[model samples]
Target: MEFDYVIVGGGSAGATLAARLSEDPGLSVCLIEAGGRGDGILVRIPAGAVAMLPGYGKINNWAFHTVPQPGLNGRRGYQPRGRALGGSSAINAMLYVRGQRQDYDGWADLGCEGWDWDSVLPWFRRAEGHEDGADAFHGGDGPLQVSHQKAPRPITRAFIAAGQELQLREREDFNTGDNEGIGLFQVTQFHDPARNGERCSAAAAYLHPVMGQRANLTVLTGARAQRILLEGRRATGVEIRRGRRVQQIRARREVILACGAFGSPQLLQLSGIGRPEDITPHGIEMRHELSGVGRNLQDHLDFILAWKTRDTDNFGIGLRGTGQLLRHLARWRRDGRSMAATPFAEGAAFFRSTPQVDRPDLQLHLVIAMVDDHARRLHLGHGYSCHVCVLRPHSRGQVSLASGDPLADPLIDPAYLSDRRDLDLLIAGARQARRLMLGAPLAPYRDRELHGMHDDMTDAEWERHIRARADTIYHPVGTCRMGVDEGAVVDPQLRVHGLQGLRVVDASVMPTLISGNTNAPTIMIAERAAAMILAAARGEDECAGHQAARAS
Candidate 1:
């Protein structure tokens, strides 16, 4: 099969890019996804995200494990990525955050022109369909849904109140590029009563609505992209595997790689477009010598402070929790407003560890359940946890080829908390969480701290505890960093340097991880990329027309 554009990975960016690019009726686009179509109820329901976490790598997730990080006492961190059409957006906690203004400005500072907050804000607004109508910062008539949970748990309210008691401002919106307050997060959920407030994943909003409807777009599921079929330095097509059949599909114009942080770099390396030293070991002839193809990996290192709770209103285990869930499910079916609509981490706060910092460098996810090790190791009871994550870390890691085989998973090493500052800030963030939890508002329901934590630990003990317990918040980026530097993989236009007819339109191009959830920002990235792609296409068409007229 042939297409004007072939997109690899039908995740958040790929889905959005296909939907936008295919809007031009004259162009043909193909999106290939390695996982199943994201149509399961577990993928749709807002609260069903919990069930998807345990059996992640098996069902709809990649569930990749990292190399034992020396920073975390030789503990291997768990990294779960959505394998379905919507990518991680399908399996993530659906908080609709777009980081701070400086995050994009920081990208501009890194030589990424036209990517500052002011320039990118329009794209962010263009991708959102906010429930609260169009405002200066939000869009009301876009494809993706951004709305509040039907009914927030009382515990979430308590968390907010506790934050207020600590003098933290209560922000009603975090999407405005100023997420420096405690508040309830607006989630990516379609709140239609008919749909029971199901999750509005990237697939649901961008791909599913237009999959078969668009004659110009082709979406292929369960198709694993093996390698980029390159002619000289130009990418001509992709070799893909489906079932036992291997086939090659041609791309007339360009191949856009939207595979997330891990998959994108892995595909690049597998296609022989990485460091010669790295590729030579796999016995594959190197096609390019880009040193930054799989380097600069950054992720938010989070620490969960779990404590047993006395209330059953929040999510938990046991007979009482089960009964509460059943009642909520029935209520959700009737009016689309219930505890079932809540994404477990209902409320959050963004604040600096100290006053000297220019912006909030840390974030908290207030989970209404005892989520330890991504909930793989469950404690037996009703409890809650405050997930403390460093918004920006100085540490970096890399993704490299595990083997020359395309079917093999890439070796992921986030090297979490390798920098001493990362650990220090996390320790500060942990202390802040304890302060908020032990505040007057949340004290009524507070039970003893779980995971053997106590208040009497010294500073040294805190550092030891953080290194022992830190894990990923699953926002990996910067593998295919976009910049003008020699180490950069892609240029500011998102075109891969030293390569033709290829581009990377995904989170992998992010020079730095955003300060919050990555789904919204990634969609924004695709929105900008789509415009650039179309603009370039238009320019080429104009040039072709001019030359044809001259020949005539």
Candidate 2:
């Protein structure tokens, strides 16, 4: 097969780039995805995203488990990467957070030029159409449709009320470059009850809308990229396995890898680009010995504290009983929307764990209603859970190949809370959670029905409970980190460092994780990546260039 560009992974980045590049009608672009087509009901429904977790890897999720982390009591963590068309965004909570200004400035501050917020804000605005309209920090017109919930649950509103009284500062918009907030979240929904029906999936936001119209774009579903076909020193194409047979596709312009963090590094290692010593033992020929190809992994560790509630009220909206589930589903199926997330999470706070930090290091994720573990664990009568995550963890891990075969799962060591400060912040967040519970406003609403955590929550109890049950808040980045630093895999242009005709445009390229959810930022990266690749193909000055991007 031949194309002007061959993109591995029809994920968020791959889908966006394929749609943008093929707009010319002159270039041929092929997008390869490893999972079955995203056709289930849970994927499209915003509230249903949690329900999709279990069924995802069974069909659409890559279902990759991480290597046991010495940091987490030698227990292997479950790292679920989307195998569907929209990638993880298709499976994520769909919170549209762009992170902090410092995150991007840090990229520019450190060798990656053209990556500051000033340069990439246009792309963010270009990809997002915030329902409220344009602002100094937001765009009103873009491919991705970002909207707010029409009818928010009362608990979410109460959460905001609590934040206001606590003096955390309540702002309607978090995307306005300022990090402070206990604001209602603006979700990626279309409208009217906001049941994730019209929410922008990567496929809906980028792929499905532009597929057949562009004859130049060929999207291959369930096609796993085995390796980058490198002819001598340059990447020429990719070898993909479609069903049972291995097929080769050549690229004329570039072979871009948008395989997220896990797949990108795994594919790179399989293609012989990494530490020569590690690659040699896997029976794979060594190419460029980029020692940092699979290092610097990062993730947001969140502690979920769930408590049972008395007097069911609205926290049991979806699960008031089997009776309520039927009623909500009925309304959802008939009208395509419902009063959910409305009165959305009352408030969220970006707080600094330590006084020394310039900005907030911990993000308080508050949910009013009693939802089970992603609704995964059986709902225990009526209960609500709140999630507290350390926004920017200091621990850095790595993603490496355990085997040379692309079919084998990559070795992912997120090194969660490897930094003691992270644990301290989590403990601090627990303290804050207790404070919120004790706040006069929540005293009536929060009965502390579950976990026996109502009265006298102590520091020792918070620390012990937090360490025992803390899990991911779902932001994983920096594996194939983009920078002009030592062994950086890609430059600010998202192009592979020291490699020709190759680029990685996904969460994998983030030098560090942002302060919020990665869904919006990941999409923003794709939008910028598409524009840069298109500019480069047109012989124009692309934002990211090789000569100026070499690691110092």
Candidate 3:
């Protein structure tokens, strides 16, 4: 098969890019996805995330595991990436958080010319169809639906009130460039009458609607890309494995990699496009040398504080809670509004760890249920959880190949808490979260602390508790850094530094991790990248037209 553009991984970036590129009708685009089409019931229901997030059966999750880290007392962390069409956006909590404005401006400061906050804000607006309608900060009509939670639990409101009781200001909007207070998070969900309260994944928003409508677009599910088909330094196509057969899908214009932070780097290294150490060690012949393919790994390492409560307002496995959930499910089917539409991690807050900090350096997610080990371990009865994570950590890690086999999982090492500074910030954040949980507003729901946490615990005790329980809150990026520096894997325009006809549009290209959830920002990146790709194609066509006129 041949097309003008062959995008690998029909996830957030690829789905958005394919839809936008095919808009012209003159260009044909092919999207290759390793998993199913991502339209399953578990993917559509907002509350189905509880079933898929733990990755127990690998339903829509990659369920990758990291190498045991010394920082966490030699513990292996779980990395649950979405395997289907929408990528992690399909299986995530659906929180629509775009990191602080400085996040994008920091990219520009790093020599990524067009990625400053003011420059990239338009792309963010362009991808959003916010419920609040068009405004300077939000778009009225866009592919992705962003909406207020239809029916947040009473406990969620209490959590926000608790933040306020602790002197944290309540912020109704978290996307207004400055997210330095507490509030309920607006989610990426459908609030339209027809599909009210369903998940608005990247595929749901950008890919599924245009599937059969556009003949110029092709979506291949269950097709795993084995390697990039390269001639010298130029990428021409991709070699994929579909079921029992291997096929080559050629690209006439370009081959874009949107396989995300982990997959993008793994595929590049598998195709011999990374550093010699990563490629030649696995018996793969070197195709091109890029040293920054799988370096600069960054993620949000979070620690959760849970309390077992008699309050049944939150979700739990108890008989009473289960009965409540059944009723909510019925209500959701009728009007698409109930606890069935909950994102689970409903309340959110951003704050500084220290008074001297210029911006909020810590973030909190107040879950309306007891969450232990990413929900892999369940506790009986109703309870609540408060998660605190350093918005930006000083530690960095890398992704590398475990073997030459394309099917083998990549070796992931996030090096969590490697720097003492990260631990210090986390310690401070945990203290602040503890204060909020103990505030007057939450006193009615307060019960026994699950992890033996006490109000008078020393800093040393907090450090021990953190090391024993902390893990990732999902966000990961920067494995394929983009900048103008020599170590950058992609240039300012997202093109591979030393390769032609190849570009990577995914979280992997972020020069640094943003301060909040990554799903919204990843979609925004694709929106902007689509514009840049089309503009370049037009430039090439214009140059060819002028050359033909001169010859005639």
Candidate 4:
């Protein structure tokens, strides 16, 4: 089949492109996703991911496990990437944060033109339909429906109190231009605009509610893109597998890969476009020797120590519990409100690892309910937990071919904490977590031990404990980094360095992982990349939505 554009993955980036490109009606877009539709019971419920991440209800997660990291005390990690529509954003805890401006400026500094925070600000605004209405730094009518928590959890209130005691300024809206304080984030909520509202993801924002009637857009789920079809030097389309059949799609315009950080790099390697040395052993012919295709992989690694408390009412009925479930079905319980939509989580604030900087280097995610060892073995035993993940990680890793077969598992090395700096920062986060627990506001919840924490533990014991339990905060990026350097897989325009008719527009292309959760930034990248792709397709000067349009 031939298409104007054959998007390889129907995740965050693909959904945006399909919606935007098909707006012209002149452009035909085919989005192929390996997973099924995004309408699963788990995918729709915003706070229902505790059920989805563990166990096997495949709505959008790829459920890929990583090779044991030598740095992580030789322990393997399970990486749940989005495999369905809307991608990981569909399955993630929807915290809508546009990371520090310096994160983007750092990209431009790396020679990726037009990617500075200033240049991409409009695109960020363009993708947001903020619930707080709009401000000079936000957009009101964009496709994405972003809003604050509807029923901010009591624990969330406690978090702000703790921050207050620490003199950390409370930011009602973290999406604003500056992120120099601690506060609740304005999430991408398609349902409600505040408090304990239902979680809204990108698929909910851009694609859902619009998928049923768009004729120019064709969404194909369970379609695994095997490789990009190359006619000479240009990418013509993609070859995919659906069920027992293999289909070929020819693209007249371009092929955009939005399989996220993991799948994107895996697809690039399977298509023979990754590092040459990594490809040769797999017995594949190299189409392009992009050394950085799966390099510079990064994510926030963290582990939260919980203390059992007398608060058994932490779990709510809107999303869980047998009794509340009945009341939920009995009526429109929220009465069309988000803040009181059954308390999901209450504790979240950013704090600096050190007092050197005003903005937080580590973020604290405090789930009122007990979450232990991968959200498994629920502490129905009445406990509260707070997760502190480093906002920035210095360690790097990659995804490479483990075998020649496309179906074979790729070698994923997240190399978490391999850098001594990363180890130190994480230790700082732990000490910070301890400080918060020991702080005045949380003293009431301190009836039990937190992580068996004691002042008597030596530095070596802390490092050992840190190495044993550290896991990803689920933000992964930089596999197909955007830069002008030789190792760069994509240019600042998100164009593959040496490939034609091909571009990677997911988290994979991030030169550095943003300071918070990666979903918002991934969507931001798609919005910006869409404009860039549209501009390049028209041969227009880098003006207006051309990504570089706002560059000073």
Candidate 5:
């Protein structure tokens, strides 16, 4: 098989890029995904997504575990990545957060040219079709739907009110650059009265509507890319396996890897483009010596604080909760407004861990449910949980090859809380969440603290609790960092170092983790990457046309 562009990992970036690039009538594009089309009801219904979270076998979640972290007393952290067409956007909580403006500016400062906040803001606007309509900071005509929570429970409201009582100003928009506020997170769903609110995943927004319509675009589901086929220094095709039948698909122009933070680097290393020591052990011939293929890993280390309540509104794993959910389903079907349409982590707060930070460094996702271990472990009684995470961590880890086998999972070490600074910041955020939960506004619903904790605990006690209970908020980035240095995997244009016809267009290219949910930022990255690719192709075409005219 052959195409003009071969995109690996038909997740968020690949789906968006395929949809955009194939708009040009002359280009032929192929997108290969290792999972299904992601059309399950659990993926569509916001609340039903609990079944797909990590340890649950519902979503095509590449439920990866990290190496033992010395900081967390040798406990391995869980990092789940979506394996379907929409990628994490299909399975994630659907929060439409763009992160702080300083994040992109910081990338530009780190040598990624044309990626400053001012430059990338347009791309963010271009990808979003906010329900709030077009404004100075939002776009209404874009493909991806961004809307507010349709039906939030009373517990969610109490959480927001409690934050406000603590002097946290309630802001209507978190996507308008400065996200320091307490509010309900706007999500990637369009509430249409005809069908209830549908999860507007990138596949739903970009791929599903256009795949069959475009003859030039081909999508291969259940296909895992094994390695990149290189002709000298240029990538020529990809060797992929589909149900034990291996095939080579050649690309005439480019090969793009949108396999996320874990998959992207793993693919590169499997293709023999990582550090020699890493590749040599597996008996694979090293094609290149890019030492940064799987370095600079980053993620938000989070801790969940739970409290018990008799309120049926706070969903739990019991008979009363089942009845409540059944009632919610009926309401959802009738008016397209119910708890079923709500992403459980509906309300949120963003604030600085310390006053010295230029932007808010800590974030909170106030869930109206007792979520434990990504919903893998369930609580028996009615309760709620507030998830607190450090927005930026000083600790950096990596993704490495566990074996040469493409079917095997990668070695992911986020090294959570490896830095003392990260622990301190997370501790501060946890204290803030604790205050908000115990505040007078939430007193009406509070039966008691479900877990072991006193309000007057010392910092040492808090630190111990944090180490024992902390986990990932599911945002990971920066393994294949974009920069113009020797250690960087990709250059300013996202092209892999010392390589041609290959590029990384996912979260892996981010020089650092953003301040909030990564789905929006990942989409923005695809938008910009697609623009750059199309422009370059147009230039090449123009030059070729001129040469043909001269020859004629």
Candidate 6:
């Protein structure tokens, strides 16, 4: 099989890019996904995330694990990625955050010319279909729907009130390019009558809508790409395995990698397109030499603080809570509004760890339910939890090959809290979060602290507590970073630095991790990348036309 564009991974970037690129009838695009079609009921309902997040069964999740980290007292952290069409966006809290303006400006400062806030803002707007109508900051006609929470729990409201009572300003919007306040997060969800209260995953917004309508677009689910078929350093196509069959799908124009931060780097190494050290150890011949393929891994190391709340307004596993949830689900099916529409993480805040910081260096999420170990641990009664994470950590890690086998999971080492500065910021952020939870606004619902934490705990005690429990908040980037530097895996246009007929359009291409959730930014990256790819193709066609005219 051959196509003008063969996009690997039917996740956020891949699905969006494939849909956009196939807009022109003349171009044929193929999207290859390793997992099944992600349109199941579990993926559409916002509350279904609780069942899939624990990583007990693979389900629609990759459920990858990181190597034991010294930073967290040698505990192997859980890294759950969505395996189905929408990728992590299908399983995420649906929080729509674009990060701070400085995040993009910082990319520009690092020599990524077209990625500055001014340049990338248009693409962000272009990908969003906001419920609030078109504004200077949001788009109204885009494919991805951004909506306000249909029915936020009272506990969630209390969490926001607590922040305000602690002197944090109430921000109605978090996507103003400067997110330095506390408020409820705008989520990627559908408010339309037909799909109201449903999770607007990337695939649901982009690919699924155009699935059978466009003959030019072909989506192949359950097709795992084994390696890139390279012809003398040029990516021509991909070799994939489906069931018992091994087939090669050729790309006439380009082969784009949208396998995300970890998968993208792993695929490159398996295809012999990485550094010699990463390629040769597994007896694979080097095809291209990019040392930065799997380096520069960054993620938000998160610590959670839970309390046994007396509030029955929050979620829990009790019989009464379960019965209430069933009723909510029934109501959701009728009018598309209830607890079933909750993103679980309803409240959000962005604040600076210190007063002197230029921008917010810490991010917090207040969940309506008690979450311990990414929801892997369960409690009996209703409760609330607060999560605090360092927005930009100084620590760095890498993704390397566990083996030469294409089916094996990559060796992930986030190296969380490796830097002393990261721990310090986290300690500060946790202290502030504790204060917010203990504020007067939440006193009515507040109960015993689950961790036995007190107001008089020293910084040393805080550090010890953090090291014992902190893990990832699921934001990972920079494995295949884009820049103008020699260490960059891709150029400013997202093309592989020293390779032809290939590009990477995903979170892996981020030069640095953003200040907030990464789902919105990942989609925005694909939106900008699609335009660049199409423009380049048009330029090539124009050049050829001129040459033919001259010859004639």
When superposed on Cα atoms, how far off is each prediction in RMSD?
4.1, 3.8, 4.0, 2.9, 4.1, 3.9
Regions of model 2 farther than 4 Å from truth: 55-57, 192-197, 311-320, 339-347, 354-356, 368-375, 452-460, 543-552
- Give lDDT per model, in order: 0.88, 0.75, 0.91, 0.74, 0.87, 0.91
lDDT of 4 by residue, 246-303 (tens): 9898899999998878888888888888878888777888887777888999988877
Off by over 4 Å in 3: 540-552
Evaluation by lDDT, superior candidate among 3 and 4? 3
Assess every candidate by TM-score.
Answer: 0.96, 0.93, 0.97, 0.93, 0.96, 0.97
Worst 10 residues of 5 by lDDT: 543-552
Residue 317 CA displacement from its true place in model 2, Å: 10
Q: How many clashes would you count in candidate 1?
A: 0
The residue-by-residue lDDT of candidate 3 on 1-552, one tens digit each, is 999999999889999999999997999999999999999989998889999999999989999999998888899999999999999999999999998999899999999987888777778888889998988899878899999999888888888888888778999999988999999999999978999999999999999999999999999999999999998888999999999999999999999999999999999999998889888989998989998999999999999999988888779887898899999899988988988999999999999877898789999999998999999999998899999999989999999999999999999999999999999989999998998888888888988889889878898999899888899999889999999888999997899989999999999999989989999999988987888888788875323422332222
Worst 10 residues of 1 by lDDT: 543-552
TM-score comparison, 1 vs 6, better candidate = 6
In Å, residue 40's CA in model 5 sits off its true spot by: 1.8
Per-model clash counts, in order, read: 0, 14, 0, 15, 0, 0
The candidate 4 region of ten consecutive residues with least summed lDDT is 336-345
Q: Model 4 segments beyond 4 Å from truth?
A: 57-59, 191-196, 316-345, 357-359, 546-552
> Which candidate would rank higher by TM-score, 2 or 3?
3
Model 5 bad stretches (over 4 Å): 193-195, 540-552
Who is ahead in TM-score, 1 or 2? Answer: 1
Better of 1 and 4 by TM-score: 1
Regions of candidate 6 where Cα sits further than 4 Å from its true position: 540-552
The lDDT, on a scale of 0 to 1, for candidate 5 is 0.87
